[model samples]
Target: MDSLSLIELFLSALRFAAPLILAAVAGLYSERSGVIQIALEGFMLFGAFVGATSAHILGDGVAGLFMASGFGMIVGMFYGVLVLKLKADQIVAGTAINMLAWGGIPVVSKMLFDVTSNTPALEASERLPNWVPIVVALTVVAVTYVLIQKTSFGLWLTVAGEKPEALRAAGVSPAGVRWIALMISGGVAALGGALLSISLASSYTRNMTAGRGFMALAALILGKWKPIPACIACLLFGVCEVAQLKLQGVMIPGFGVVPVQLVQILPYAITMFLLAGVVGESRAPAKLGQS
Candidate 1:
């Protein structure tokens, strides 16, 4: 590829990876605090629907983005209450949240827009600019890196997740820390969803996230829950997606056209290999999910 083509390819990869980066960063917050947040998919869906609908109605993408983050926080807090306070099964609660958000968005969309699949297309101003996702991804990575590695909150989070009793002895509430982490996770996930709908696509389609949430989870594992490394993993996966889209027609002399499915499978395959010890074992919080 020429220089221009390479630059274009990198941009496309960044765009595709934006949502995964956001979601992975969010997952980092939750898992680092001892909560297994499998409900990231649901949170992203909720954000996408809310952001798209708000933008369609108000014709202001910024407003929609803010509204989506607010709603995501509410939902995240709810999840925190259920899992942290009520002591519900984290996995089950997360799955339910995903189902509820996924099913609810379409139902609401159909009722409001007279369509079961998607809302109306947004105007240019009502959709996020191309650069928004890149900015958000960078911001999340930077903030998370500092928060986990350079702050007292980070120490508290690590201690809470590794030894809650010790945290309690030190007058910190482990449950509270986990709750805050989950809420942050939810907000970031929602931001990812907003990026998907407003920045990447003008309308919200059913299952638009299409397993990106799981991919983010894989990134979290591959990155070993560290912000910078996790961000790299997200970018790597995003590059795979971009390659799949751009390499569709470029013919290789001997290899011929690469199968689209194979390209699609690359990120997951990489995830598996990383998890299988090629990258060393991932060390989660010792007290994660323990009462």
Candidate 2:
């Protein structure tokens, strides 16, 4: 490929990585606060629907993004109540949230747009520029780094995850810290989905996230719950996705013509492969998943 082609590819990689970065960071706060973050996929799907609907009605992409965050916070609060107050199993609660997104969206869409599948096509004006997501992704990463490394609250978060009893002795309510973390996780994760529908695709479609939420979770594990390292992992995954896209229908020297289906599976396969290798060695927070 030429230099320009390489530049374009790099830019594309950044674009694709943007949402994954946000989602990973979202998981970062949740898991770091001792919550298992399986609800990310559901949160993203909810955000995508809310964002697409808000953008379509309001005709402003930025406004739509904010709306999605708001809804995401609500979803987070709901999740928090289930797990924290009701003492529901975190993984099962998260799965229920995902199922809610899958079933509830079509009903809402039908009521609003008379379409049970997707929202109307968005105009160019409603879509965000490619650079916006990259900037957003990096800014979130920097902010997360500072929050995790520099703030008193960040320390509280770490303690809450690693030792809730210690946090209690420090006179901080671990549940309170976790509440804030879950809210942030929902909001940021929703931004990931909002970007997908409003910036990348211009409208919401059913199941549009396509497991990027889970991919972000893997990135978080690979990063061992650190902001900068997690961001790097997300970028690497983004590059893999871009490579898969670029290699579709291409002939290899010895492999002959690879099937498009096989090429499509490459990124996901890489995710599972990397996770299998790394997760066993990576240490999680001490108090993670405790009810």
Global lDDT of model 1: 0.86
Candidate 1 lDDT over 1-291, as tens digits, reads 699988878887888899999999889888888888899999999989998999889889988888888888888999998898899999899999999988898899889999989989998878888888998888879988888788989988888878889989999898888888888889889989988999899988999998888788888888888888888888898888876777777788999987777777776787778767645667777877774
lDDT of 2 by residue, 37-71 (tens): 99999999999999999999999999989999999
Candidate No. with top TM-score: 2
Stretches off by above 4 angstroms in model 1 are: 2-4, 254-256, 277-280
lDDT of each: 0.86, 0.93
Query: How close is each model in CA RMSD to the real structure?
Result: 1.8, 1.2
User: Which residue pairs in candidate 1 collide?
Assistant: none
Residue-level lDDT for 109 in candidate 1 = 87
| Superposition-based RMSD of candidate 2 using all C-alpha atoms, in angstroms | 1.2
C-alpha displacement of 170 in model 1, angstroms?
A: 1.1
